[model samples]
Target: MTERPADEKDIVLAAQRGEQAAFSELVRRHQRRAYAVARAIVINHEDAEDAVQEAFLHAYRAIDRFLPDQAFGAWLHRIVANAALDVTRRRKVRDADELPETVASPFRDPAEKGELRARLTEALNTLPARQRAVIVLHDVEGYKHAEIGQMLDIPEGTARSDLHYARSQLRQVLGALRQS
Candidate 1:
């Protein structure tokens, strides 16, 4: 007889008990989505990857505090989002002394890059981290308001408002892109 794979609840229970393999399973299962969340926030692939790694490490250490009844993915994504935002903050501080104009932009590297994506990325960066995260989670990742709220540790109504405001800001900023 073939063995059934352990369910998430069981995995969470085991991980909370200090089982290394169970935590490893959790990491294996959620790392890709975590990377996507981090990537949406950080923009840079290297920074996103680092954020994902740091989030997983923090999750592992904090696993004992996690409740199996709660949604593990949401909890993990929250950590991933925070880590990604930290990277962006650190990067801004590190680059504060230099003008961005002095460096060649990734946007200009490929002539075929979509103008809309570039414009959208810039617009997203202008918003507050929470608002940016809400918009990306809702529109780009297709997460519902409640799920986004849970992942970001905000109220569902706040998530909705954030998304609405973020969309309005992006629309205003990128209005020229639509015209062209």
Candidate 2:
């Protein structure tokens, strides 16, 4: 008889027992979502990559302490979010001196789309970090407020309020961009 592949809980269990390959499998399975969570916070590609790598390293180190009763992905997502926030905090001083670059979009007129993307990025960056994270986790990633609260360590009501505030801010910013 052939052996079936291990499930997530089994892989996590194996990893907890010091199986490196099992942890690698978990990373491979969840890397995209991890990266997305990191990127949504940090906003820069290289910083997001660094944050994800850092999150994975942190996760690997703590795997032995992981409880299999909770969802592994949720645990990882929270780590990634925290790592991204750390990266954002560290990059603030460095970012002040960096010039912004506009990428031309092939789908729309280069200038218009590039300008729009830049404006949107600016709008997102202006929000308070918690609000930004809440909006990104909820609207962009389609996570529920309860899940966001769990990941962010906030009350569910706080997450909902942050999302409301973030959306309102973005709408005002985007409206100004449209008029100008």
Candidate 3:
């Protein structure tokens, strides 16, 4: 994507100077991507929103440590992803039956979409959490393997392997769906 307006640098500088309006503008600019990353990990919309909000708070507190050389969006996304994973970890301890939702297209016809989605969701649920996260991040979310590795604290090789395994599993599941 093209760089944010040159004024964004000014906003960042102002935000770093503790200007609330500048910080709010940063939030407004980045919130959608942050929420998408969070929602991809956390599954539940409400929890993802909460995670994004918490991430913004955390990012604000840690803004002093943010490296200006790096893109602000990537940094904020890392925060949101971590917060979302944290939420998932906590929820896992409380809910044994929890499963991540399938990544689905919304533009399809309702009845056919529902059936296909149900099959895909079942397949996704059968994969382990780490594999699911890797697949969703790298495949559905279009994150680079290195970025996914950094977010999940795994090696790039590990992310790649997980994605491979996830694809194999998904293929098997999807094949069964076709057969049925």
- Name the top TM-score candidate: 2
RMSD of 3: 6.0
What are the lDDT scores of the predictions, listed in order?
Answer: 0.84, 0.87, 0.82
Q: Tens-digit lDDT track for model 1 on 10-59? A: 88887887878888888999988999898877877999999999999999
Point out where model 3 deviates above 4 Å: 1-7, 97-113, 177-180
By TM-score: ranked, best first: 2, 1, 3
Which pairs of residues collide in model 1? none
TM-score for predicted model 1 compared with the true structure: 0.84
CA RMSD per model (angstroms):
3.5, 4.0, 6.0
For residues 1-180, write the lDDT of model 3, one tens digit per residue: 123445776777778879887888899999988888887777678989989999999999998888777778878887887898888878779787866578656444536747776777768877876787788888788999998888777899998999999999999988976775
TM-score-superior candidate, 1 or 3 = 1
What lDDT does candidate 3 reach at residue 145?
92
Error of 2 at 43 (Å): 1.4
Weakest 10 consecutive residues of candidate 3 by summed lDDT: 1-10
Residue 45 CA error for candidate 3 (Å)?
Answer: 1.4
